[model samples]
Each structure stands twice: as structure tokens, then as C-alpha cells.
Target: MSQSKSGCKNAQAEFSRFAKPLVDEALAHAAQGEPSPDDFHKLRVALRRLRTLIWAWRPLLGRKFADLERAYLKRPAAAAGEARDWDIAISLLGDEQTKPDTERLQTARRDARARASSTLAAADLKHALREMLRRVNRELNTSPRRTPIKCLARERVRAARRALRKRMRRAQRANRGDYAPWHEVRKGAKRLRYLLEFFQPVLRRRESRRVKSLRRLQDRFGALNDAVATEHLLGQHREVFADAATADAALAALKRERKRRRRAARELLG
Candidate 1:
């Protein structure tokens, strides 16, 4: 679908419209007892998109309000993040060898889920999100300066692309097996992907190829990162393990997977 030609005002309104329902949906899902992984994932994704929009329009919103909104979102996002990490760990490393770590993760996951539910249920959260949208609308209406959203989108996309390229270059130049460098590249890739998706309506047809390439890179990086995260989690909670050997085995398997994923990512980059 084509974006409205009107410009930033229309874009702000469109973003507000898209964001409200996602917040409502997230709140509703959180209200349910033991929200599913899918529900948490959806909530995380919704908030991410909202944050991305704010970031893309930082100049329009002004830094103070943008920082305020982002800070307000951090708690809920972290809650969801904690739950998500456990969810991913359990899903990927649930074999007998990882049973000890899995159990610990499950305990942590339950705590995270409870925190997420409580945070979502807070009346202040809904009120703040509503107020944020209202403030953004008000700011957009009152601001004297105006620019076409397409122009802004193009500028942001180019900037994101440049950032991704720089990160990729750094990753390529550094030790290929270094998880830290690759993880940084993954984050850049994710940001670029989000930007592209947000601006797809204004992008040209040929951009689809770029989108696909970014997606593939993101997937590869995500796989490697997930393994690294799981291994880290297991290592951090070693004292909680019922069977240290089991945890060790799981960590070994994760390291092997990380290597494989790193190889795949390198090949894709080339």
C-alpha cells in the first residue's frame, strides 16, 4: 500500500493509528494468565516498531520528548525481553543435555512473565502510551516546519544503510569468529531491516532485493546470536545447575552451533 502523499503529519497520524491497536493488543494479551510466547513476541515487535518510528522522526518530535517516550517504554520492553530470552533458550536448548539449564530458565521465565503482566496491568502504562500519542499529534500540528515523509524516510533509510555497511565492514575486517563484532553487525542489520520495512511504501521496486538481502543477513546473525545468548545464560547460572555436566554439554553444543552460524553469515556477507 502506498503511503499518503501529504507528508509528516499524515505519517505521524498513520503511526499513531497503527501503534494504539498494538498497545491495546499487547495489554490484552498480558492480561491473560501465562501469556503465550507468541503473544510476548508480538508485543515486543509492536513496541520495537513504535520505537523505530520515534527514532526515525527524532528531529520532528524533538529530543526531549523522544527521550521521555523511549525511557517510558524501556521497562515494559525489558520485561518482554527477559521473558523472550528465556523463551528462546528453552525452545532452542530443551534437550536432556540442557535440562538443568532449561529448568533454571523456566524459573526465570516465570518471574519475567509475572513482571511483564504486572507492568502491563499498571494503569499508568496505558495512560502514558495514550498521552504519548496525544503529545506527538499535538507537536506535529503545532510545529511550523514540515517536510515530506518520503523525503525523511529516504534520508533515514540511507543513513541506516550506511550504518549497516560500516558495521558489516568492521565485522568482515575483525576476527570472523568474534561473537561481539558479529552481534553488533546483527543489531545494525536489524535496525536497517526495520527502517526498510517501515519505509517500504515509499521505496522503489528494486529495493525488494535489498530487503531480501537484509533479511537473510538478519536471519543468519540472529541464529548466531541466539546460540551465544543461550550459552551465556547457561554459563551465568552455573551455580543453579542440578547437573553441571548437562549444562556443560549444552554449552558445547551451543558453541558448535555458533561456529556453524558464523560460517554461514560470513559466506552470506561475501
Candidate 2:
């Protein structure tokens, strides 16, 4: 058809080629009855990358298919996320100081892993994803949009960076102890980083410095997010601890860590 349509189709084909192997690998990893924590992590990351690409191309794909694809991807990603959170918690807490808490986290990890495995094994999920991809390709082929693939990629990257910068500024202006703003900033940084990664091939040399900065920003915010999640998880299961005093001490330490991380992130923003 037209030049823009051709560009869009080419871009879609490129993304599908890049994503298919990753999806297959994730599915294979999840098919195992007892996949390693790394397996789930890899699957979740693969899904995230795919979702980011879809989001960047949402305008061409339309709202209906984009929403459907997002929903399909979200289920397994969330399941994997639960398992991953527990894995991180278990690793960070260690076995020495909180034996009872450690045991409880281990049990939670097992349950999350089982849930993730079950979700991944569902045949409907695979069918839905396959159908969605088919629909996406069809739409890209027929759509009247004339925007070049590189133009679309650049627009998305710019938007992601602007959103992240705005959020970071708000977070920096907020009180240091305000966890909500920092968490929002963390989400923004994550979205921006993923978008940058998806557009890396299209905008390679120009994005090198931006990619490095985004990574550092994401890491700082991710550390803060993990600390906050740990504190909340420990609070939720406070009764499981052998000594309430120990639980309190652990939570206090997490809070201190969170504060330290928040400060570090803010310093970066400034």
C-alpha cells in the first residue's frame, strides 16, 4: 500500500521476530513444574519488553487490541511478580536474624511459585496471545496511519522521558519521608527505561547517554521500592514472627533503608 503502511508493517514484523523467541523461551521455562526463580524473572522481563513495544505502538494498533494484549500479558507478569517479590524478600532478609520470618517467607514463595506455574500452563493464555498478535498484524497492514516507524519510536521515547522527568521533579519537591511520590517516580522511571530499551535499535547513538541515566535512576528507585515492599510484607505477617520485638526491629531497619534510598534517588534528580 502506502509508504507509512509499509513502514508500520515492517516495524511490526521486526518486533514480532524479536519477541517470538523470548515468548517461547518464557513459556518453556514456565512449563516446568519447578522452574527456578531466575526462570520466572526472565519470563517476566521478556513480557515487560513485549508490553513496552506494544504500548509504544498503541496508536497504530488501536485501543481494543492494545487493551486486550495488555490484559493478556498482565496476568502472567503479575503472577511472576508475586513469586519474584517473595524471592527478593527471602534473599534480602537472610536466615540469621529472623528465623521464623524467613520460614514464613519461604512458604509464601512456594505458594506464589505454584500459582505462577498454574497460570503459565493455561492453554487459553497461549491462544489469546496468538490471536492478539494476528489481529495486531492485520491492523497494522490496513491502517491509514502514515507515520514512519522511526518517527513513532522517537515520539514515544520523548513522551516517556517527559513523563518521567515531571514525576521526578514532583518527587524531589515532596517531603523526603513521603513514600507515595517516590513510588510514583519509580514507576515512571521504570516505564521510561523500558521504552528506551524498546527504541534502542531505532535510536541507538542518540539514546546512549539517556539510557545510562535512566538505568541509574531506575536502580535507585527500584531499591526504594524493594525496601518499601519488604516493610509492608513484614508488617502484614507480623504475627508470624517468634518475637514481635524482632519484627519491629526488622521493620525499623527497612524504613531506615527506604529513607536512605529515597535520599539517594532525590540527590540524583537534583
Candidate 3:
């Protein structure tokens, strides 16, 4: 078949190959009655990767549909992240005077897990995921006019790279007390990393080599995020602690860690 007649690179087959395992992973973990903290994290990763994949194809796929698909994937990941965030808080609270807070975190984690499981297991999300894939296949198969596949991939990956660089600069210029800009840089780094990996086949050697640096950036940014998030989470529920002093101590430790991590992450931003 001519290029215009069948413009996509067997996108239906590629789409299934990339998306099915993630769907299966999500459903499998969702089915577990008592999914572990790791399970919730894995589910979040799968959902996040699926969202990134959709965004990577946006250059070829219509942006409106791609945006809608990404939004659809966001809910399950957010649900799963609630559980995962509690897990992060639990780990952050050291074995000092955190016994009380740890117990509360565990309770919150259990609740979040149940909610995540229910959200994932519900027929609506599953149906939506299936329907999204079907629509992707239909669009790819029937769209007569389309961008060249490799060109499309290159444009998306390069655009992600440019966006990441811009974010890093903005984050670097942010005040030491303002964490929001830094947090945005973290997200941008992740998005670029995922896009590069997804379109590696069409990437230049130097572009692919940048993954190592991106991984290091992620490590630093992730450490800072964990500490800051733990602090924020604990601060929000401080009143729940039976002893006010215990909450103070936990927050104190988290602040120290957050400062240290913030410094480390800032070094990377520069």
C-alpha cells in the first residue's frame, strides 16, 4: 500500500504492543484484594508510562484526542498515587518517635489502597481504557493524510527536550524558598525522559545518551520531592496525632532532609 493509503507504521499493532501490557499490569494489580505498597507504585508507573506514550504520539495523533486520552489515564494514576504517597510518608518517618504517626500513615495507606483498587477495578475505567485503544486503532487505520512516522517521532522528542531545558532554567532561577518551580522541573524531566525512551528508535546517538544525565536528574529531584511531600503530608494531618510534640519532631526531621535534598537538587538544576 502507498504511504498516504496506509500512513501509520502498523500503529494498531504497535499501539497494542505498547499499551496492552500496561493495561494488564494495571488490571492485575487492581484485582489483588490486598495489594502491597509496591503494587500501587507499579500501577502508578504503568499508568504514567501509558500517559507519556499517548503524549508522545500527539504529534501524529490529533492533539485534542491525545489530550483527552491522557486525561482519562490520569485518574487511575492519581488514585494509585494516593496510596503510594502514604507509603512515601511512612518511609520518610524514621523509627524515632514516629510510632504514632506511622500507625496513622498505615491506616491512610490502607484506605488509599482500597480506593485505588476500587477505582481500577471499576468497569468504567476498564471500559474507557479499551475504548481509547479502539479509537486509537481506528484513527491510525483510517486517517488518510498523516505526518511521516519517524519525522513525527523526532519532532515530539525534540520538543520534549526543549521543554525540559526551558523548565530547568526557570527552576534554577526560582527562589530557594519556592519549591513549586523546582517541582515543575522534576515533572518536565520525567516527561522528557519518558518521551526519549518511547521514541528511541528515531533518536540521535547524543539524544539517547542524554538518558544517563536525565536519570541522575531524576534521582536528585525524586529525593527532594519525597522529602518535601512527606513534610507536606505530615503537616496536613498533624492534628490527627495524639501528641502534638510527635508531629513537631517528625516535621523537624523532614525539614532537615528536605533542605539537604533541596540543595542537592538545586545543584543539578544549575
Candidate 4:
């Protein structure tokens, strides 16, 4: 089960050994026309875990398979995104606020649920899953997994550090008034954070500490994004507004919150 013994190619060997069974299991379930919600949920989980596993091993594999990985996995993740978004919205608003926005939120929740259901209904996902599993298994079968853990870990660390440096530079170059550039800077920071998190086991303690700081930066940006989404959602449900003054005030408050969060994100990241 452990591929760490395979000197230089530990990550690739480990990923294949660890993830291949999960992929195979998911594909087999899909092929059997499994209709249970729990089955689909398991499939989705398998896909996500495989994707994360590959991402952590990407440096060893190079960019050649990046497109293939995205093609097969990203679509399913997108199919699940709406539901996840609604879940996030609910979690953010808390139970107390759920009443006031129940009708509208319910509609969004239903749409997400529908997407999840429809995604499983589509045979392409099943076929795609099987096909991807076949390809990955084929590659692993032929390849010796020659890359050692040390080499793989070094590559991941180098790449993550490079990404962090690049994002910090971007933040330095971003203009105070240019929210777009700052947003991009935040995105870069997030990538570094994710990379570090994915490879945490291989990273040094100081590197992990840096990863935590970068994660805090990402969290700040995520909060700002949530504020923006909240503002947009509130505006879109204008028909539910009881009074003109209240609606106007709500809109204004939304905008103010977004503005404040953005500022806070920038300060925290800086």
C-alpha cells in the first residue's frame, strides 16, 4: 500500500496505489447504474479525492495530463458546485436568518439538488469516469514510478514557494484603487495555500507555518467573496422586499459590507 519505499517516485506510486482503487470503485458503481443518492455522493467523493491526489502529484507528472485530469474531473466538480454553493450560503447565513429568506433560498437549494441529480442521470459522467480510470490505470501499469519521494517533495516545495513569491510580488504591484488586480493577487495566494496544504506532509514546519498564513489570506478573500455574493443575492430578490426604504438600505448595507471586507482582506494579506 505504501510506495515510500520506491525512492524517487514515491508520490506517483503512492497516488496510483492509493487512488486507483477509489476510482475503480466509483466507476464500477456508476456502470452498474446505481441510482441511490448515497452512491452518487460516494462517486463524487472519489472524484474529488482523486483530483486532489493528482494535484499533489502534478509536479512529478508534469502538465501533459493536466488537461485530461481537468476534462474528466472538473466537469463533475462543477456539477456539484451549485449544491455546494447553496450549502455554503446556508452555513454562512445560519439557522436564524433562514426564515426571512426561506422561499428564495429554497429555490436556490432546489436548483443545486436538481443539478446533482441530473449530473448522475447523465450517462456521460459514468462513461467518463470509467474512461479516466482506464487511462490512469493503464499509465500506472506501464510506468515504473521512478521518481523518489525526496525528489517529488523537493519539486512540490519549489513550485509552491515560487507561486507564493509571485503572488507576493503581484500584491506589491497592485494599485490601491485596482480591486481586480488585488482580487487576482488573492487568487494566487489561495493557489499557494492549497498547494502547501496538499503537500503538508512533505513540507518543513516553517513552510507549513507560511502555508497557514497564506490560508488566512485566502480566508479573508473568501469572506469578501461571500459578502459580494450576499449583496448580489439580496439585490436579485428585490420582489421580496417589503418596503422601498428598507430595500434601499439593505442594498446600501450590502455594498458597504463588500467594501469593508475587501479592505480588510487587503490589509490582512498585506
lDDT of each: 0.74, 0.73, 0.77, 0.61
Q: Per-residue lDDT for 120 in model 1?
A: 69
Candidate 1: segments with Cα more than 4 A from true spot: 1-14, 101-105, 175-178
Clashes of each: 0, 0, 0, 5
List, residue by residue over 107-161, the lDDT tens digit for candidate 2.
7778878887887776455666666567777777777645566677778888888
Q: What's the alpha carbon RMSD for model 4?
A: 5.1
Ten-residue stretch with the least lDDT total in model 3:
3-12
Flag the better candidate by TM-score, 2 or 4: 2
Q: What's each prediction's TM-score?
A: 0.85, 0.86, 0.89, 0.69
| Candidate 1 TM-score versus the reference | 0.85
- List candidate 3 stretches off by more than 4 Å: 1-13, 99-102
Q: Which tens-of-lDDT digit does each residue in 165-190 have in candidate 4?
A: 67666766777655565566665666
lDDT of 3 by residue, 26-90 (tens): 76776667888888888788888888888877755789988988888898888878778877887
Alpha carbon lDDT at 45, candidate 4? 60
Q: For model 3, what is the error of residue 103's alpha carbon versus the real structure, in angstroms, after optimal superposition? A: 3.8
- The superposed Cα distance between candidate 3 and the true structure at residue 112, in angstroms, equals 2.0
